[model samples]
Target chain A: MTETLSIETWRLAASYLFLVLLMIMSQLLKLGHGKEFLMATVRMTLQLVLAGYVLELVFSQQHLLVTLAIMLFMQIFALITIFGRVKGKIGIGLKKVVALALFVGTSIPLAYFMIVVISAEPFYAPRYFIPIAGMTVGNSMTGITLGAERLARVFQTNRARIEEALMLGATPQEAVREFLSDTFSAAIIPTINAMLGMGIIFIPGMMSGQILAGASPLDAIKYQIVIMMGILGSVVFAVYLIIQLGYRTFFNERAQLLGNED
Target chain B: MQNAFSLRNVTYRTILSIPSLDVATGSVFGITGKSGSGKTTLLKLLNNLITSDTGTVNYFGTDVLKIDPVTLRRKVMMVPQAPYIFPGTILENIQLIFNFNRKELPVQVEIESLLELFDMPGMLNKKTANMSGGEKQRLALARVLLLDPETLLLDEPTAALDDENARAVFEYLAWWVGKSGKAVVMISHSEALISEFGGSILALSGGQINSFNEEGSVHD
Candidate 1:
């Protein structure tokens, strides 16, 4: 296969013009986003550059333990992002539950994709492992965060309804079943919408990146299809696990609903 | 008559601190207090909705904390001040009790009878979301009555009703309690209603019982 030509440093730096354009537009419209835009651009560039160097070293080394360690780091970062994004106070136990859900949700599908589907030769090839894991973990993180937030909000706002169900002899599980179903559906909607619009409205980032890196369009499409399926599976699994396990935190062993103190 | 509920030194945070109280079947126990005096909190303790930091609440003879909360709650239902109507028709909301218990739903005639009893015969097919405050309260009552609880912990069940409707609700509750021999512990601000309907009254102040009047008179 022919190697893809790399962009010169000057050409890469030219991308800053887009950020400058955005800042100009923000200034003209008085949108108050000019500073935010500038700061975001700086952060993105610095983070990506550092990440590129780290990836280069990991790829060259091809050490299985190193690859696994990086994967663990990515999972931790994703979990932290989810915890940070949650709006209200969450119990420490619930936070651990969230992390466990993400781990199980992303790791299972990722293992299947790497071992059974792609059948990576060395099994932990960073080139194949990191990107796929990144996509799966990132998407599942968002899904679980949305699911958790929706669950908390629904429980808080509809306390009377939940208690009414409880009063009528419903268990905590039975009482919040509808809300859990709704949260799962709401969490996965963005992924469903993206699937609906893919190829027609816009090319997904992973597929486009693959194509730009000199992979055949057909090969890129195959990878994209499997990765998207893996992501969808992970998100569904993560959200379901979260709603199922996370709900128990809201109630005690006697099935009494825990107040705000928890 | 059996003692329906007995509280001893039940303190729930700073919201409530009842030293001792007993509610018996075949009676209506009125709990009167200013807002934030923990009237609702006391009821929640009886149903095991909230555990007290101190003391025991006994349902029948069993400590409420020792009993299965779901089982205890089924026998001691609570109707909050602002009742929540589940997302469904009035008929569906009434049938929800069976759904929760996993029992066979009552016949259409029984549902219709309940609606009639609640003075909401025309609302059988009406959506709960469209119900007025008074209608929702009656619907909530009808729903709980179908459960046939031994005790009803009502937080101002008729607070949203007009004078006539409120009177009708109390009368129905009185008749129902008399027929079933079930106890009702209700929170109410209306002195006249308390005097007329309350078999015994407990007035709360600053999270403690200020007065206990068996005659149901205004305690000053």
Candidate 2:
């Protein structure tokens, strides 16, 4: 039974293999070096195999502290990724603050919904908390990165337009409102598309996993709905926070535009 | 009319330090320089795109830096050098700057008048991406002009045009200058064109306004 490749595992493995192969193929074509591809394949196999074992331990132990620790680490990693991607300087140290904001902003409501709202057992179950947190933080990370980057780029490129808007008697919000609108909508489209495709074109990994573990279709569907809502919430919160913070950072209290200083 | 745009010691860095210039009310001020001389940067500063590090930009009596951005944009609109024809029809691109319906807000008159201004009345509903360089420049100018800005900051408004099209654009701008009495600041390297228009010329070099010629000289 364990050796057999079920529909779920087969789909998962094939998708992962396809991505790894594509990356390898692109690199190979560029450098004519098969060594990197070989190394990457080996690394993927080992990492996934080890991660599977670690997940088994995590699932069995279900210790709240360990789960919380893992969640925090993922959040920190995501924050750093966002900082590097948006601000273009990894050492800017904005990640810690952003991490705190993301955690407090996303996790508390997620925890409440998972615990008090859904009433899932052990409250901090790695199976529930870790994956859900991962989904939420992952989406928020993308939104914040996109928002920050868009804000910086628009400000840099469209200075005349922005300033012209300002001089035309638009408030800071009024001046940048259209640009922000386009950017925010762009940042949220992925999450929106995921929601649109949920269970129709693609069965999410979590839902499929629950089904594989013997949960009924209805039960899996319920979890999927809850998680999807959480992801949407996270995206919305992140976008709002980043825009608010970005506006404050981009302009002064007297409505003067600020330069992109290090 | 009041002096609509003013800059006091307006120093900015974009590859070099840009010098300050004051534009009088109701006149065309031409920003002339060779390539890479920061004409675009000065336009951006006057338009309030980038804040000066150590000076104040005043619009009328109010400090432009302190003014709201949206208000600033409405007052001083810039038609960029390379027109960004957005992903729609010519009408849609113009409609992007406002919140009202295209049909409700004198779309045909605005479109017709602008097209008539540029003498391209037949190209109203055309897709902007497929349009040629001269067409795009005309469309971009039309869109900005529809906003009715007090200060028009045009970057290479005729760079892409042929002799005829360039002449048409200049004629349209000259007519508008005569009618509205709004400040028109343009960046042009064309000496012959500057001589023809005969506006005050501000020469930019190493980011500074090196010379100001009110008589519109052939050489800086």
Candidate 3:
């Protein structure tokens, strides 16, 4: 195997030239975003370096508890991001569904991938488990956020139509059927488009990273394919769970639509 | 048991309160008050769209809380003040209601006759998207009326109608009630229309019963 060359400190520092160029251009144009750009770059460096140290420690420990803790941490972080990033207010009921979908939707697929697809012996091996779980959870987080937001928006807009159906003796499920289908479609479209554009439109960041890390091109491509499939499965499952369970939150046990959705 | 709806100590969110009210079967029960009188809230309670905060609302002999909401709505349907017109032809709007209840659609001739009753003739294929407010109101009425629910609930069923058309519509409702042996609970702001056709008129003031006229006559 050909070992990839490592960048030295000075060489790594040279990468800041790109940011400096961007800031100079912004200044010349009077864009006023130079501070934001600089702050963002500094924050990214700190976050990635922190993640690197943590991963390095976990890799050395190789304990089941440590790996599981990391997995849980990733999941909670994803859940928080989903809740925070959604555009409008998410009702308490729908918020619970989002958390449930994110946890179960990603975990089940990840377990299956670890057991059957990759067949990791310990299954909680940090090196294999953490990256894969991160990918799965991250992709599903986006899908769930999109699904939750769209579901809330569509329900708010189509409320009168839904109520009219309910008055006509339609079940709550029947009333929101079309809206759920539409929300599911809207949520998953980004993932589908990414899939369509995978090889031709852009080589994925993971595959590029793997190749840069001295893995064979063929090996990198194989990992990319499996990871992409894992992502798609996770996203579809999470979004499906969200739309199905999330809509029920809008209604009561008696099938009466509750007060206004947040 | 002869009453279609029996309400006792019903109150809903400062919108409606009825200490004791009975809507008789086989008659047109008119409810009237100015806006914010909780007229629509009463209809919602009857249809199970909302449960009263405090009080029991019974349908026929059964407490509505014990019944499934979907089944309750099918048996007692409502048409709101500004009815929603689906994005389709008039025939589709009618068919969609039957679809909701999992009942078979009526014959096209039946739908045509209903439209004719509402002063809309030969308009089954016309798109509902372009319909006028009054036409949409009538189309909504035609849709629910075709379903043949045991009790019909209306929220200002003729606010969009002219007096002549409103009177004609009320006459048809009175005739339908007499013919079918079912009941109707309608909310209207116009006292003259209620006085002319309503069998038992109810007037609400600030969500409480201000007057109850059993002879269907409005009190001066």
Candidate 4:
């Protein structure tokens, strides 16, 4: 059993040399990404450093209120990010549905994973909760954004086909049925592809992080598998919720298609 | 004779402002107007597709807003101009629309006969993707006809047809409505076509009805 090797502050600074090399090469090639490279390097360093300090405090406290509050913050931040990330303005109705889906969708799987699967001591264990919450919430954010964007695009492009169905006595749900299926598939593909390519395509970040932190490879792989399942569950459920509820936003109370679907 | 739809003070944005109008059942209630004269909007209001900003629209004496929109639309089907021809065979398009409404599939013979009336005999298995503009319009009409709705709203139902084909379609529509005592509210750009077959014509100008044959339905 070998002890995990820790990088001291001075040694960690050496990583920046690789970024500098990339930025210099880009500048030499006139690829026009040198500034972007430099900014990304600085941003990553500052963000990770702040996150590490905050996580240390959160882990030490282990207070239920503190744990829940941080999760809530993560959820809200993810909600705002989805709004910003989606291409179209998600009308207020869909906005509410997205908010509800993110909260409920992420929380259900998270509660089950923490309380039942890991059975973390006292159930609010920050070490177990925060990382898992971050992964599930982050993945769900991506899924919801994709789902929302696809839903909006369909309404725009397929307006005539949808209205025709409506004219043939189709319900709003019936009119958008094919598009919803398309949206759901489009949203979940990235998550599904990652699952297919796991380990073969690349070692996942979580598994690598655990191995570096001195966890056994067997234990790390097990955690990765469960966390991956948790992420898939969150993304699928969140996307499903958004697809089902978000589309109704394009229709009024009488199930008539709204002309202003921006 | 029963009025299929009656309107009073129905205003929808700047597009329509019909003070009063009545469409009697059991005849072709033809509507004529230039494009953007609120002809289509009037049809939409009849089936409760769009709510009027003011005034009540009554469907067979029931205030349209009170009826469930899906139920109302099922009974009063409205086919738009340039109707969508779905990406499959004519049969598939018909089957899909029936599927959407949860209606039972009509017999193969029944479907073939309807297409025959629209001059699309032997088109059941023909791919809709290759249908001409006129054929697609007829296909859309035949699809709705299969539903056998209580009322039909058609926007420019014969706009793409040659006179011969258009005459055949109009003749069938007259027969179809006469046989069942059903009603039709059709918007036609051609005044002559609508005037001849249209039992009680309502002409719209700038979103207002300039003329309506209030007593013509019973005579027709």
What lDDT would each prediction earn against the true structure?
0.85, 0.72, 0.88, 0.87
Residues A94-149, model 2: lDDT tens digits: 34435555777677667777787567688887877877888888988887777666
Evaluating just chain A, the predictions reach TM-scores of 0.93, 0.78, 0.95, 0.95
Tens digits of per-residue lDDT, candidate 3, A1-262, equal 4799899999999999999999999999999999999999999999999999988988887898888788899999999898789746789899999999999999999988987898776888888999999999998998999999998987778788889889998999999887888899988998899999998999999999988889988999899999989999999999999999999999999898888211
Give TM-scores for every candidate, taking all chains together and pairing residue i with residue i: 0.91, 0.69, 0.95, 0.95
User: In candidate 1, what are the lDDT values of residues A1-262, reduced to their tens digit?
Assistant: 3489899999998978999899889989999989888998899989999999999999998888899899999999998898888835677767877899999999998998899888887878999999999999999998988888887888788877887788778999999988988998999998899899988899999888888889988898899899999899899999889899998988888787877231
Every candidate's DockQ is 0.52, 0.18, 0.62, 0.61
CA deviation > 4 Å runs, candidate 2? A1-70, A77-101, A121-221, A228-262, B14-20, B100-104, B215-220
lDDT of 3: 0.88
Ranked candidates, highest TM-score first: 4, 3, 1, 2
- Which sequence of candidate numbers ranks them by lDDT, best first? 3, 4, 1, 2
Residue pairs that clash (backbone atoms under 3 angstroms), model 3: none
Q: Is the docking of candidate 1 incorrect, acceptable, medium or high quality?
A: medium
lDDT string, candidate 3, B29-140, tens digits: 8888888888888888888888888989999879999999999999999998878888889888888889998999988898889889899999999999999999999888
Tens digits of per-residue lDDT, candidate 4, B1-220, equal 7888889999999889988888888678888878778888888888888889999999889999999999889999999998988898988888898887789999999999888878888978898888899998888888998989999999999998889888887887877887888889898866566556757788888988777764344422
For B1-220, candidate 2 gives per-residue lDDT tens digits of 5566767766765434544556765556788787788788777777666677777888887897677655576677777787666668877766665542122335587678777777677776778779887888787787777777677888898898888878777766766776888888888866567557656778888788788886445554
Query: Which candidate should be chosen as best, given lDDT against the real structure?
Result: 3
